[model samples]
Target chain A: MGHGGGGALSGELTRHLFTPAYGNETLGGLGDSAVLPLPGARLAFSTDSFVVRPLFFPGGSIGDLAVNGTVNDLAMSGARAAYLSCAFILEEGVGLPVVGRIADAIGAAAAAAGVVIATGDTKVVEAGHGDGVYVNTSGIGLVPDGVDIRPQRAVPGDVVIVSGPIGLHGIAIMSVREGLEFGVEVESDTAPLGSLVEAMLAVTRDVHVLRDPTRGGLGTALNEIAAASGTGVALVERHVPVPEAVAGACGFLGLDPLYVANEGRLVAFVPRTEADAVLAAMRAHPLGTGAAVIGECVAEHPGMVVSRTGLGGTRVIDLPLGEQLPRIC
Target chain B: MGHGGGGALSGELTRHLFTPAYGNETLGGLGDSAVLPLPGARLAFSTDSFVVRPLFFPGGSIGDLAVNGTVNDLAMSGARAAYLSCAFILEEGVGLPVVGRIADAIGAAAAAAGVVIATGDTKVVEAGHGDGVYVNTSGIGLVPDGVDIRPQRAVPGDVVIVSGPIGLHGIAIMSVREGLEFGVEVESDTAPLGSLVEAMLAVTRDVHVLRDPTRGGLGTALNEIAAASGTGVALVERHVPVPEAVAGACGFLGLDPLYVANEGRLVAFVPRTEADAVLAAMRAHPLGTGAAVIGECVAEHPGMVVSRTGLGGTRVIDLPLGEQLPRIC
Candidate 1:
């Protein structure tokens, strides 16, 4: 009954979760590893693991979530993700139907992002020895010439941008985890951002930093960038976009939306001169329709991040010393 | 308290299970990952995960087992391994010292193999959601040119050689898991084979199939080669040199050593004309001091593996239908 058996359980999980999120023509039906064609461009590779609980939640399941998560990570690096490797850890007694649903979602997500799932592995654990399922994905992409973006490249006065509203994914998962159902549905913000990043990159290659607000969310992500780049970041609370439903959910849970995760959104810092052009391009993309300029890099208070409150007060945002929601992707 | 926390518990496990069996300078320090210099050859990369339970047993602990396991996998390609990436999945509340011992053992194995640990990741899981710990290691090695060793290269009449004994790892894990300890020490044959592989490659570029029999044992590995190369394999069981302790352990457990796991050994298929030279080179290496010729490839019975038993009877060794011993690294 273990996930690694290659029997009914394993087949069901793959058929539902993996195939749906990552299916592609050339993936050779998902073997040990995807044999990929190396393009001429320089390669950028990244891997991530998702251990989110409540496999099925508002707006998404772990299947689509895993695919979009890796795709976006590749996008943040301004790379065209070409292939992916998926490894699954499944717990005994997980329903076959649920696994199939997840795989279908993976296939759909991969098709939507124009990426392929080339290689994969499946391992199953006894009921008490594993969570429902944990997914790890490693992706390889092509970074085009004339494009150079890194956190260290951020400079003073550079504008910071958020691709869309934050905290939706985290709040959505929390609601499901706590069995809190709202009258109005609060969906997760889980979607691939490759096109949005492509559009932004097309406008200007001056984008210095691109990060998804996952785990510790926007607050922690910006703080990391500040620390890594040895620069300070200042943000206007009023300028940061948060969906009303997400705000209400966070308020009820006594959680800071800024500390909540977002799967479909990205935070980008671009040169001051090209900020407007990049914002315009971001706005044109479907995934970045609500994109906005949130803040600017500052020379003062190096390695610090501060935000101006609506009532004229400012507060320092620090990196989280611990996980806010463990296993929430 | 997850096994991968990089905290006290993880540290303890590394020290106990890993350091004693495979201690060395480069691995003794136990960093995030191993760092080894490439020294001017194209790197061959591979990775594997160990989820074996009953942490310590006759053959080895998961710590030293995983370290040498990945090193041998890379060595199978005739590459000089340089670095390793160790990632852990620790269950909550696992003892700190247990984790440390595992880390220490990893360090020792890396040192003995002359590799370095350059990077690592640790994650903790809630109790009852995971086993003790699962270790995944990725290794990079430098492969010189004109060394095109692959399973597909096994030709008709190529001699199959096994460097040292086999199945010690699998039987050791099984014995501990079942609480059937042998009277005598039945250690897992866990050690890095990089030097032995280097010696064989030094003698000839005609080495075709290089494999380490880990999961599903020697039978499965050879079957994989047969299928990949569209050939057949014939094994002389009388000629295979399994230790008395291993044979006794397998007999008591009603298990076949040929189907048991081995962490520190390898099987090489080479041209008959060059077999002696390769064997001599293997014998000179400390790890392969017990090297022996156990099998050969043939054109007939394509994609099959047959063994000549001690009674001189021929028997087909089919690929294992299901896992004989789950979590045997």
Candidate 2:
């Protein structure tokens, strides 16, 4: 029932409604981004609309999420993000200062990500017709040669490396969220991951799958990769990194940290032989300081994810039925 | 007042706010589309978010406007549009059948425009958080060789040609709009103009400026050109083609047809000697059957627009402070 959940409902909507309408070769790839072949190069394109309730949150605002979210999608395709287009739908009664702040945030984020906002559009709706502001950003990036990253490329004997701690982004939003905040404020881990991805690719081009654990967090991202490759993912519970604050928040809220959304974390599926090099590369980066090898693709339970718990028990991390929290991104 | 009017308010917002934020070489062109250059060719990039209320009017729905609007923006740069990205913000509780109908319209419109919907995104808002649906489309197009179309290229003695009748789109939306219907029904001229642009380009490459008279209509579009080129546009009232139905509706509504929106029309600035051939080319296209030479750029009264009325008196046509009709696109 949660269409915004980025879980089964979102997947079903795509398969049943969107795919039937606009399905084509490029979209059929169904990667984080669509890889388009240009005359001399391949261009990766992706789009995302942020509808977060509280425009301003602890770590970042909707502006930061708007820019980094699309940048990460493009990066997941092993592309260096180049250009972006942003469109804003604003409610008439929202203050100009708020719009100005958001604009400043976008400009700042794009500058940091090394991508230019090349084109943009703006529209205003009557007071009650829209939230204060909702932003949509679509980006284009250049995929370097020798990079053949894709979810379907993941195979048995591949090591799974998570770039950093999970659930911070969603928990950060929830902390400042109206009627949902906990005692302590948590900052969103919303940072651009393009440079981090480039660092990983520099180590080796054998990286099979690169995913940003975003909307449905690590669990949803891994489930998608597993299904796409027709391979099973075996995650070690104790090895997955989770910040103390995020864990505490999820524990208090009776939520699984795995399903909480994140803004600036990535998961990599690399060849077993190249795991150490890629992990080293990721750890050296500032955004990837918390990198950990949490899991690996296995021959068992193809198209599923099973976690080996510290208690000597195993549990299947299935795709979430609906969104645990809506608009966390 | 009329944030969607695309007139003075829109212009000021771009000049004072957006320009300072994201303006660059490509965006500074400030045409209907921004022309981007790749290695081997020039690409036109444009974005527009359709917040047109009622979603559906007499002749077309938001889906048609979403595709055709971006396609026309690309064609304005003499580019053959190739790819498009569609993003929809739908309010929860909106029926799937309604979404299905909108999708069909989008597919039909894109097919008609000869552009592919390469990528798209959908975000759901809580029922009251958004209107039924709002669509945003950003397009990329390739400009052919020898085409250097821009508003600044409009020189004195360049004849201004209207591709078809004006005011139909706005009047049509208003006619059936709640509490505003007239005695008769009028249809929105919401059609793609890419093929028509191709036909005109086939006739001559010397055409200077191509602009689709949309939200703010003919007067505002001409004012923009005049200001961009530091020239004045002189319009002949009798020569400017306005369909009888639209004229009659505007007369009863006490609205100037000059300022009403048109969706399926374009105004061009071409050398006087090449005007007839261009007009003929426009007429040969179904979308441009009502093509007519409405005016010419003049050196006098630079950066302003004046009309030569049927009564032989000259009257200045200023850009409206706000829109006369909102969401008429």
Candidate 3:
């Protein structure tokens, strides 16, 4: 189970298992998406499978996540998603209406994202051999010329900015799973971030690195960037955004807001000179209204992420060994 | 389970469930793979998920099926596969070595097919929630400029030819699954068909249709083409190739060889004038040595497939309502 947690175990599986087996340069880069140079265009490709426990969540369902997750992966590479291929693994006894609802949600999500479901496949497993349904979506996007974004491009003097509040999506799923709730309901912030990324790129194409803080949240995403680029990340803990409902829920649940998963948010590492312009452009978009600068890339303590606490002490934020919440996305 | 049977139930699901939900031109076409016109090239994209039981089979495993299935789909579009993205949904508690062997198979299969595994993803489901593993592969291929192959292009004057033997894959899996044995062990005819398709195209780009008779075998594939092209098919029952072991197994199992599944064979609809040349080209390829012309498209009885019996009688071959063997792919 830890191998799917998107943490240290997941990283090890890719390094020791997948990379050794695959032995390819494109996959060796370990980016959020693989960019292939075609005849006249460079295309970004990515894939993700959603096995969340509950079929439907507070603000979203697995259907929407299937679309947005891959779309966000392509956006991280500075690409506008153009087409998606969807495949479903359905349990035998599941009702047709349930499958219908999920398909409807997928249709709506693709429409909202301005992408087409170009191809699809479906398979059924005998009951008890599968959850109700599992959806896998793979996307292809066009990378505009002169725009380059990758984890390895992060360098010293880069400013780190997050699109919005964290921990809501993780806490939202947990609240329903465990039947616990704060005074205000926390909804999964699942939405397409392609336009938000395009807005930032419009300001400048010099964005060094862009990653969506998904399974292991903002803290783990920063750690990955630091390691991939061989630079250090210095964070101001107080500047990180956490909604009151999410914070209250995490407090009772004994969870850290920084390590919770988010579906709709992204962490961008831009050159210090372009940081202000990028932040302003992000704020101008509807999905990035809560955007804030939370950290900076530093030359000290390369490959590590250290945070300055509100209590005037510093602590290292390590990659999580396993998931605190499994199957949240 | 019948919904995944590649028969009548599967067609209804696609027509009433998927088509209404998706409501797009490319998806409505319902080709084995979708051909998208990009800036400088037309690309073919396809996706498939492998949930075959007993991960390891006689001649191939789910790993090779995951690669070859999607690759064959792209090949049916007259495109040589360029790249594939693989995703795995693993059940908790499966051994690492098992995953390693499967990954090695995928790597070797991709290398043999002349395609690259460009990107991948993995997710783990808790024990009892899934089978040992389910693999999903999505592929992208570049379509040649002057070659156009699709189901609806099968004209009445087209001649039908099959690449090789049928019923071997389905019977091989059944022999292992049910603990039944014939005098000689039957092996799955699982092999990549991209090179064979290219060879036939070299003979004639005027080939109208090409489909890998996978799940529902030759009987169902011809029905689909007949329905799609609004034509009738006349098959000579004696001319369709079936190996001795496969024929013996199907006879004892009370199954018709026409409806049994095949992995490596293809059914092509070529113009009557070019059929001889294409058949010659197919016979020259390693994978198509057993190729034979079995039938022809007809103007009588549109949208149906009728076969001439070995007894000199004629009968309609209906699309199967449900799977005779489940999860054979």
Candidate 4:
């Protein structure tokens, strides 16, 4: 189950099974999205499977996660999602009302994201053969002209900005999973980021790296970008936002907030000169209201991440072997 | 279970759950594939989930089935498959060897079909939360110019042709499911139809309907076409090809081969004038070596299917309420 951890195990599995088998140009990115140049348009294609244990969560349900997740994936590639394909695997005993609720969520999420569900498939397995419902959503988005965003584009002088607070999504799901509710609810920050990404692109086409810290949380996402770009990431730990309720819950569960998952947050790498404008643009969006510049790419210790501790000591932030939570996405 | 039957229950579920939720122009076709018109190309998009009980089957495994299944869906739209996105939901504890074998098969099948696995995602659920592995593949194919194929395009006087002998896939799976052996082993007929469809298109662009009889077999596929097109179908029962091995296995299990699944076979509806040329083209392909004309669209009893028995009697082959075998695909 840790394969969903989005950490070492997931990387190992992909490298072991998929990389060698389907080694080709478009699939070579191994990024959040695969960018392809179609005849008349450059498009981004990506797929995500939602197996979140709880059908419903504090802020949203799997429905919102499924749609927003894929849309955000395309957004990470600087694409505006236009069409999506939804595939559902439902268990036999799941009720019609539950299905209806999920459908409504998907429809609403797509509508909110300004994307259409162009195609879809539904398959029902015998009871016990599957969980209540598992959804696989694949999307195609149009990559705007002049915008080239990828982890490989990150460089030494790049500034890292997170769209908003992290660790909320994982804590939200964990709260429901463990049936423990904090006094102040920690809801999953599940929302579409097409507009947020568009806002950033409006400011500058020089955006280098864009990634949603999903299954493996912020730590794993940063580690991946660092490893992929062969650059070091130095973080001002205090600048990374964390809500009080989320922090309290993580501390209670003995979990690192950095390794906890998030659904709607994104980490962006941009040139230092343009980072201010991009940060302002991100901050203007509703989804990016808490946007903050938290780190910068460094020349030393390439492919590693170091964060300044409150006591002035540097701590190596390693990618967890596997996420503390599974199916958080 | 039966919801994936591709029969009455399947249609009912789609009508009740999926149809209303995803009622867009392209999705409403509810064809084997959704036909999409991109900026510079008309494309066919389709998705299928493979949850066959035993991952490894006799002639082929779920790997081959996943690739060929999506490719065939695109081919049904008279399209040349170009790219596919694969998403896997694996159960924890599945051996690496199994995953490796499946990936190898997927790569081989995609290479053989002349399509590329463009992008993919993998997620693992906890042990027992899933069967060994379930694959959901979504594909996009280019619909050639002057080609328009759909079930609703079928009309009276259209000729119906089967690409090859049917029921091989279903029986192959059943043989493994029951652990029963017939003197002769039945192999799965799973194969990509991209080149085969191209061959038919080369002959004429007037192919009205092209459908792969996977679940619920030929009877259900024709019944669906009849109901969708508001036309009656009359078949020559004796002309329907049934392999000796599959027929024997079905006989032993007291199953109707007409309702058995076939992964590689397709039934085409063509105009009477061009049927001979199209048939000749299909017969020239190795995958269509066993092609035969077994039926025709008719004027009587619209939205129904009637077959002529060897005794000069007519048999109404109603679509089965659901498939006899679950997860056969």
Cα TM-score of candidate 4 = 0.98
For residue A170, what is the lDDT in candidate 3?
A: 95
First chain TM-score for all predictions: 0.87, 0.98, 0.99, 0.99
A56-134 per-residue lDDT for model 2 (tens digits)? 9888899999999999999999998887888888888788888888888888888899887878877878888888999
- After superposition, the stretches of candidate 2 with alpha carbons farther than 4 Å from their true spots are A179-184, B179-184
Each candidate: chain B TM-score: 0.85, 0.97, 0.99, 0.99
The best candidate by DockQ is 3
Kindly indicate the candidate among 1 and 3 with the higher DockQ.
3
DockQ of 1: 0.07
Q: Stretches of candidate 3 above 4 Å error?
A: none
Off by over 4 Å in 4: none
Q: Rank the candidates by lDDT, best first.
A: 3, 4, 2, 1
Candidate 2 colliding pairs: none
How do the residues B1-329 of candidate 3 rate in per-residue lDDT, one tens digit apiece? 99898999999988898778777888877889999988999999999999988799899999889999999999999999998999999999999999999999999889889988999999999998888989999999999989999999998889999999898899989999998999898888888899999999998889899999888888999999999999999999999999999899999999999999898999999999999999999999999999999999999999999999999999999999988898988
Candidate 1 to truth, TM: 0.81
C-alpha lDDT of residue B265 in model 4 = 93
Cα lDDT of model 1 overall? Answer: 0.72
Candidate 2 i-RMS (Å)?
1.8
DockQ of each: 0.07, 0.57, 0.86, 0.67
Q: Which whole-number lDDT from 0 to 100 does residue A212 have in model 1?
A: 82
Could you tell me the TM-score of chain A in candidate 3?
0.99
Clashes of each: 71, 0, 0, 0
Compose the digit string of candidate 4's lDDT tens values, residues A45-68: 888888998999999999999999
Model 1 reproduces a share of the real contacts of 0.07
